[model samples]
Target: MEPGQLRVFAQYDRDLTLEADAVVVGSGPAGAVVAKELTDAGKSVVLVEEGPPFVPAEYEFDGGLSMARTMREGGLRTTSGTVMPTMQAVALGGGSLVNSAICNRAPAFILDRWCSDFELERTTRADLDPHYEAVAKFLGIAVTPENVLGRRNLLFRDGCDALGYHCEPMYRNVRGCRGSGECFTGCRSRAKQSMDISYIPAALRGGARVLTSVRIERVLAERWRATGVAGRVVTPFTGRPSHQVRIHAKLVVLAAGCTATPVLLQKSGNLANRSGQVGENLQFHPGVAIMGIFPELVNPRFGATQGYQSRHFLREGFKLETLWAPPAITAVRLPGSGMALKNRLADIPYSAIWDGIAVCNRSIGRVRVRRRSMDPILSWKLHPADVSVLAQALWVLSQIFFAAGARTIVPGVHGIAPELHSLEEAEVLRDRPIRATDLVLAGNHVFCTTRMHGDARLGVVDEMGRCHDFENLYIADTGIFPQCPAVNPMWTGMALAHRSAQQIAQQI
Candidate 1:
């Protein structure tokens, strides 16, 4: 059968029942990889997604409209304990559809720490190297071309060089990038190698079916073995349940995501939380942005969204990177009102934006399931040390801008001085008591909610992504990460999914 002939669950008018050798309850990088691998090995697979399949033409250039169409909770999902908004994509390809497209492999130090701290002996760098290579090749990963590195990225590089800090062009998973500076919104040119255009299509060609606009309500368990899943199709516009869906399979893979996967399990009466680790140990790479005003026209909105990142502070649990957003997003996040904001918007062409991402957050969070709607409720609080680190990172970012000859620096902090004109004023930011509410914080990467460990009491899954309580249930998302990987977790998450597929293939 042709790939386009695969069944879409939402098209059905009545209740449906399907059978597959494996059922994967997500369509992100991890779910896509798992579905593709299982089908390629001659197993019937069904990939379910809670979001719609967005064609390239349907993607919008406007940030607000794009977020409303693609992001979870219209990009307004926030934590309860802190003011940090969690930005996650809700589409067929998950965050890969809306991320910066940066693809960094798990750092060697992080892998070593996982092995030593979590006893993830099977997840060593050497063991996962081939999987990483395969994923990179499949995604067409390459360094952003220097010619396309717009003025904002160039300014960041200059600042890093002036400070003798180590910085390099980021490797991205794009094949024919046009430097549109719209990766966060969604790549309209089909240049971004997201899973929708990569693995999902391949899986379809291998006879795998995809069910979009459907939420997996629960995994059907039979005496500690996964039997399949039951869920309902949701209306694309209103996001309300419509048609009932039930799929029977020999195995079940939960790749929904860090936030949704645990919520699903909890709402299903904690099927996989025998060890009580279903929704614990959440770690997000909290980040803050700063804009530098340059004497020359920086034109931050005209190139790669994120082209370069500095590793100078990686050991300090933070990384500096250049970023860009459309005028609408940039205007709202500029930290001003009416006239002040208008003036800043007028100077958009001369401003360069960058972010210092705190990768080593000790602040643990949780994802609770709401009883009525089954939606996820996130709770997180920044550790005291994390607050200090964030302030230090902002200070460092200001210093970098000054070193790069910025005319003025607009720190994105809430109550801090609006603009720092000199090194002395920027230095004062280092001593200011920055509260959790004083900074504009956001995170896209979340992990460790259903972490993997050899010991059952320590984690919900094993090194191979198998749930400790169920023999045939598996998790193949960043939600199983032992801790924050201190880098973009896309490549690492895919590699882990590939490993999980291999293990499952062997078992079947």
Candidate 2:
């Protein structure tokens, strides 16, 4: 399909099928990059996605409703007997639509560790620097400016300075962003530079067709060669039901994120045992929040969700990032009954909040493909080290609030009231141990389920992002990230997608 060409619809009842030189599943950051790269190399491409198309300007600025429509499984519920909530976007732009605009590359120290300990070659930051630079330029990545740091973000930086914890404004992917603080619910101004606005648009302009509201079930394989896929396209408006449609292609690329990609490989059956590592070693950078009462109207919802982050404790297995939520969401976390509710609601606009995100250095999980349900089973077990890291990070955050002259500070743990009044009160929190379920955590940065590596026995994909036992099939999503970066995972995911796309373009 070329630009400005006629439309092509794939209907199920008509046994309508389409053939292409390459088929890309999932229209997020990875798939968009892959499709554009392949098509630019003169290969015909077709992209399939399961969620509705989102025009950034068309989406209302409602957090809850937008999250329900764009996020997967209403933000996947962990089945690991822990309340460790994690969320990911399922729309055409994938997580890029519902993520904080912060765009940090994978930390250098983490990459060094992966290469040194895991023996991953050609995976160093130096080797990937050109790719990162290109991606950053394409997304228009830039650091948050001082003028855009709203009062709440300012307070976070001021508190960090007072407490001797280093903090600086993080970089973001945006063009003329007005600091609306609505990144979680999809950028309403269309300035946030999500994949929908950047890569996907460029891909479509380069003559690639994207089909929304299409759910890919499995990769069609024959004699270890992945020829195409079998799936369905629901009615765009009603979404009642539809028949099946199979797509034949010379190449298949999987960009279905950490959960879906692994399950697809496992469900394919022929590809599972070959690597024997699909759906294993899932990693999530669990996040938590802290709120402090301020004398002025801080309006925590005015700037970037995570503009400033603390790097003081990065070596301690914890990374602190500043974040806040909408009034309704934050109200549910505040402590109180009668008098407390009255006091809290009155200070909702004035409350100063900062999220402390912990990128666990040791926690691991698994995603199992259930035969009965199409959705994959998600399970995460928190390690002892993760719990200890949470405790240390919380204590540090509390001390910073106290230093900043906050009289009351609320911890993110469930059922835990504000624990700090004076510096003396904050000292007691350092002694308290945080349990796995006690800490409230939710992060969308997940990876490693379908990790790529040099050895096939330990991972699902090779370093080139190709599946082990299948020819002409590749995984380009975060699932192929062998190690989870201590910071946000989008930049790393996009860069790897670009690399994988180049490899596929060369072969085809």
Compose the digit string of candidate 2's lDDT tens values, residues 1-508.
3441222233334544778888898877888888878878888888887776677655656557666667766654555745566776777788888787777787788888777765578888987788788888888898888777788788888889987888889888887767788887777778788877788777777777677677788788889789898887765433444767678999899998788887777777636446667887888888777788876778777877668888788877777777766566678777768996777777777777776667765788888987755477888887878877777887888877777767778775654446456667665556666678887777577888888877777777777788877768999988887777777778888888888888998888
How high is each candidate's TM-score? 0.97, 0.94
Model 1, residue pairs in steric clash: none
Per-residue C-alpha lDDT of model 1 across residues 1-508, encoded as one tens digit per residue: 2332444544668877888889999899999999999988888888888888888788888888888889878888888898688877779999899888998888888888898998778788898999999888888899999888888898889998999989999999998888889898788878999888999999988888888888889888877888999999887746888789999999999999999899888877788898888999988999899888989887776788999998788788888899988678886777678888888778778998889888755898888887777568898889989988888889889988988989998887877788889889888789878898888888888999999998998999999999999889999999999999888899999999999999888777
**Top candidate when judged by lDDT against the true structure:** 1
Candidate 2: 10-residue stretch with minimal lDDT = 3-12
* Residue 218 in candidate 1, Cα distance off native in Å: 1.0
Model 1, C-alpha of 468: deviation from truth (Å)? 1.1
Report model 1's TM-score to 2 decimal places: 0.97
Q: Looking at model 1, how many pairs of residues clash?
A: 0
* Cand. 2 Cα-lDDT: 0.76
Clashing pairs in 2: none
Instruction: Please list the residue runs of candidate 1 whose C-alpha ends up more than 4 Å from where it truly belongs after superposition.
Output: 1-4, 7-10
